[model samples]
Target: MRKLITDRRLLFGYILAHLFIFFTFEQEKVFWYIFTATMLILISYSILDETEQRESRKFHLFIGILSGALLYGVFWIGDILIDLLKLPLSNQITALFKLFSPELTWHYLVLFLIIVPGEEIFWRGFIQKKLLTHTNPWTSIVLSTLLYASVQIHSGEFVLILAGLTGGFVWGILYAWKRSIRLVIISHLVFDLLLFWLFPLR
Candidate 1:
């Protein structure tokens, strides 16, 4: 159990935490609070690990920012594709925005900074790393993507799960090749920011 809780296992815990919040709390505000708190915890853990590893903190931070922008670009491209295809998935995304409407100023802050950072730490840094321990690179990628999608399951979230799986695969590949949590984090943040900005909850 102790071995399991190593950064990798903690990431699984983070996913579970989000799933819990999504199902248990009906209010968007409550979910945001839970999300913010979880992100802080994950960030603290990442800082401690980086310190122990004796890596350049500044470098990792830079990677995080750059990766996020790149990922956002990827997301934009995907959005364009979806538009061209005229897929029903776009409607689902729009519905999600409506469900979370009247988002507070602080919510954006938490979403961009804390939530994105925390998720990057867990999925890219922890889960992917852990998966690599017992599996081949490609296997780990698939498993991580599936797990990522599975973790997002909830009522009225089928489209989200599909998107999660697709994004997870891309992010997992980037994380595997670059071994940079920053890249995955940046991609995720950009993807989400665009989604929210363009769609927003009605």
Candidate 2:
């Protein structure tokens, strides 16, 4: 824990993420602008930090698409359970969707082209992979997931934080296994497409 906190590069990345995400959520009117800027910053950092497998590989796209669909099913089941249990999360979830969901065509373009890839590359490919050297793969995954979830704290929506945890865990494991940014990026993009556009929970 101390080592992780002391690690300059990791610490820098975390601070950057938290700072930008905080700003991203704080300004609702210019949320998209801040969000886009945050992703760009992370993408720049990731490319400079390490050399990841960015090339397309065999079964990567296929597996990414399938895994994304499977993750969507997991969330779908969770949504059903939440409704069945009468959880007080629907409004929070709805609000988060309203804030983050792409309503314009350009929003979708930025989401698919910039946001998803930037997130996967930085969180799973860079941060999680960097954590691997300090601890076991599982520990790295969980820690990265926690860090990812923590960044969403400023959103003031429990559901969004939970989504960060859940999605981060899946992508963490995928990157640990595949070591392919392309794969995780595709998977994340597919998941976002389904959750935000094709079939939103709310």
TM-score (C-alpha, index-matched) for candidate 2: 0.92
Candidate 1: Cα lDDT at 54: 21
Best by TM-score: 2
User: 25-142 in candidate 1: lDDT tens per residue?
Assistant: 4555477776677567655654454322221233355555565566556656766777789987778767766665337888788787787777778666766676666567787799
lDDT of 2 by residue, 137-196 (tens): 789889999999999889888988898999999998888787777889889989989988
Question: lDDT for every model?
Answer: 0.66, 0.86
Error of 1 at 144 (Å): 1.0
What TM-score would every model get versus the actual structure? 0.70, 0.92
Q: What is the lDDT of candidate 2?
A: 0.86
